[model samples]
Target: MAIISWREQMSLNYPPLDSEHQAFMKVINQASEDIKKRHIEGMEKMFQACYDYVRNHFSHEEDIMERIHYPEMEEHIASHQLFIKNISQFRQEFETADTVGKKLDASQKAMAFLSVWFLGHLISRDKPMKPYLVRLRNLPPRMNY
Candidate 1:
């Protein structure tokens, strides 16, 4: 079973971002299930997919923020940076554990970290961007995401 499930309340009413968030939720849920089943290979694959997706997603989001000149851009970017750093650290731990024959434990820890961080970030940081996104929605289609 998956650890985290997506809720409609999590939506920020921005299609592109919402779609990305939904995709993230799917990956995290699958990863959580893989961890619970002790499927080391599956977990590793999911982790790599998530890591790549997050990097791209964050870059796209930051670009949007920059284009919009969001007032809280610095804070938001910092948060994104922290997330990337944390994921990198978790990846390192996972790799080290695998080298030491502790893959299961490290995978579980990584999944747990991702579950908590994903939900918290979506609610606290992403939700607040709704207003800004809504305003952006008013612009021409090309300008909007």
Candidate 2:
């Protein structure tokens, strides 16, 4: 599994939000590496943490989106739902695997899925929302996540 690489392109020109995004990527990357190393138990905990982080992050982002009257809020949240679905699928695979070996085997593709989803979303879909977000937010929104 490949680690999610953060770069300038990932920056939405919003420092606070971008920082949270970076942390999200960090958690995902750690989980990916753990899975790749066949650290099954570590991987499981990290993956759970990743899911929790994503949900909290999305909630905070959505709140900002709503407060700022972000027009694409629904679509953005829909994207979040897709990520959660992917997370659930991986969790299911991890849970159903009869052996640590099977878990690791299944983890490879799941990590890849997460890497691709994160890179694509942050660079393409999420990045495009920044301008409107900047205009709407006007200031850093309160962060509860």
Candidate 3:
């Protein structure tokens, strides 16, 4: 079962960002499945993918926020940073686990965190950016610059 699935309500109406979010869902769901199957060896790869998503997607979203002059950019970035810190802790737990049972426990904890965080971030952070993005696109070409 998926930790969470992509929904239309999650879309910011920006294809680039929306696509990234959708792909992120896939990564999280796959990680959840691996955990279910006791695929302990694959957990590291899943963690790496999550890390990569945080690195690339957070910056991409940040860049768009800069372009749009988002008022809450700092707070939004802080949330992203907090997520990085939280995920890093989980990864460390997984890595330092002395046995497969310990590793699976860590993976379960990580997935639980990811599921809650991703949905909450989408609703609290990204959804509000929809109007700003629409206005940005609607701006005249000269003014957009």
The lDDT per prediction is: 0.79, 0.78, 0.89
* Candidate 3 residue spans exceeding 4 A from truth: 138-145
Query: Candidate 2 residues 37-144, lDDT tens each?
Result: 678877777677767767787887887787878777888889988888887888788889999887886677677787788788887667877888767536675567
Which residue pairs come into collision in candidate 1?
none
Off by over 4 Å in 2: 136-145
The collision pairs in model 3 are none
lDDT of 1 by residue, 1-145 (tens): 6567778899888888999988888888888777767788887887788777777888888877876778888888888888888878878878877353477777777777888888888888778777787667556656435
Tens digit per residue, CA lDDT, model 3, 1-145:
7768777899998898999999888888998889889998678878998899998999988987887899989999999999999999999999999999999999999989998888899999988889889656755553333
Ranking by TM-score: 3, 1, 2
Candidate 1 RMSD to the correct structure: 2.6
Tell me which of candidates 2 and 3 scores higher on lDDT. 3
